[model samples]
Target: MKKTFKVVVDCDDVLFDCNGYAVTKLNREKEYAYKKEDITAWGELGCGLDERLIYFRDPVFVRDMPVLPKAREFIQALSRRAEIFIATSVAAECAGERVSSIIRNFPEINPENILIGTRKDMLKADMLLDDCPDHIRSAEVTYPVLFRQPWNLSVSGVISTTTYREFLTLVDMVQKPEPEMDPMSPVVLVGPSGAGKNRVATALEETGRYRRVMGYTTNAGSRAFYRCVSWEQFHYKRNDFVETSSYMGEMYGTCREDVESVFREGRIPLLVMDINGAVNMRLEYGARIIFVSAGKEECIRDILSRGLPLEETIRRISSIDGEMKNETLCDMTVSGTGFRVSSLEKTP
Candidate 1:
């Protein structure tokens, strides 16, 4: 028989009261995202949501935050039978503070048991009881017990419960197997403006299995763009036959040999470039291409929301749009809206 000895719990509405706490204290304008109507607004914090999330992550804040009735009791009871954890989402800005907060709240619980700022789907657990449908839906857990509440009403495949006693009963009965990870194949990714080529590339890199080709180019505003060099430096550094291609008074070249070097390596190469580049590569080597795209408004929204300097954001957007208009590219087209690396790789 397999070992059955671990459970992870969500901190927000499942353990503490989120909707009530937000209603009582959360500032509408500051805490919530911008919307034309107030009551109609969902729990999205628009412009500075990433920043405001930092406040709640502090040890002073979390310890003082009210714990739900029977939450501590249920956890204590479960702790006797299995290791229990308080897992919650931590925003990028205050990831440290969030971990500190959980450690302070439950001194008895080991620091390792508390995880924050994690993709719930990536978590390895025998069972997970959360109020958020996204958390349970995304995770491949053995027993996904949905704590019955207004927030979790729409979720499917959940054992609804009003009390911790009831939740514990369901947790005791379910049996689940460890999920298997399906490795991705070696293939090329393509996308238009607002399509998530860079994002997809990053996701693949994170797996540590895919060997992606980083293209060498002249557009180096950010590291995301190709590695750039001036005309004098390019010619001096690389003593090659001079081929001139000027854009906005700046000269650039595609180093054919450097791209070929990537193919020589046994890794999957990621070439993030225009349709011409893809076509040129296809002619040289028959590589597969996957296209990525997003709606105009969604693209603008995503770009602006990243907390980058406004000028830099606008410049990148303009450049991406320019490429989209110019390129006539590839095999499969995927939506850039709400693009997640795991979702894209899993898609057929």
Candidate 2:
């Protein structure tokens, strides 16, 4: 069963492009060239007068301001797995206009979920996503997430994220999983590079019965979904990693928090890792390890076809032999060519 989280998201800069629209409006109407990045503080429009007189009171700004990029898409996606509520602090007079804009832009959100007031802390929820530090600090009971804003950049100690995708990741991390009679154990999918482990992991995730525990990596290509951390950050949080390994001069590690988060969501946590990381997970957490193999010849062919440097290809080929030596430690063995969901059945 999937866990449902009561997510309370703030309006203004979070959902609506308030600052972006304000900057554009000021630039156009007031003959001021104010850029979006220049308005770092709330209500303090670098130009002398507070933003209320210039922007908020304007009917056009209140009713027709554009939604932030990807706001609608992510909110819709999150609503499928969790209950979403919009909590804002717009003025009473303009609240109706803001609500109308929200209804027009996001019809999937129920009108009742649109909360307008200053006292967001009064509402009950599992998590609070807002840009204002005051609002986050005020909501003492709910898990406060400081949504990324130039104004709140200096604030610390709360989970902060810049994008809606990152917000969803944090939501999944916080919600506890539902209890189950036949609870699924955490799974570590191990194999040589290009040996079809990632393919199998993706298939399992698509089944909606598994959640991929995204690992931190230095690889630039995987930075979109994978957590990208600096060398300093990796060292600072080294102890939190359940498993860590180096590949092609880059470091990768699975954080313990991500794994626990997936388990809390009542879905199997799937990890695709190298043999070294696999050994570490098995030793540290007794994680269910599955050895995925495509035979030595096929592994080499796949690696070479991927256009990796010959040296790296050879290194991967050599590592496969060492990985296969640890096959005895795995709970299950799956051939890369014959990968199937049935092969994942729990051993008796």
TM-score per candidate, in order? 0.41, 0.51
- Cα lDDT, all candidates: 0.55, 0.72
Q: Return model 2's CA RMSD, one decimal.
A: 16.1
Return the clash pairs for model 1, or none: 33-46, 190-290, 190-291, 191-292, 195-292, 195-293, 211-268, 213-269, 213-270
Each candidate's number of clashing pairs is: 9, 1
Q: List the residue pairs that clash in candidate 2.
A: 177-264
- Give the TM-score (vs. native) of candidate 2: 0.51
Q: Where does candidate 1 stray beyond 4 Å? A: 1-4, 27-42, 45-63, 175-348
Question: Which prediction has the highest TM-score against the true structure?
Answer: 2
Reference-based lDDT, residue 268, model 2: 84
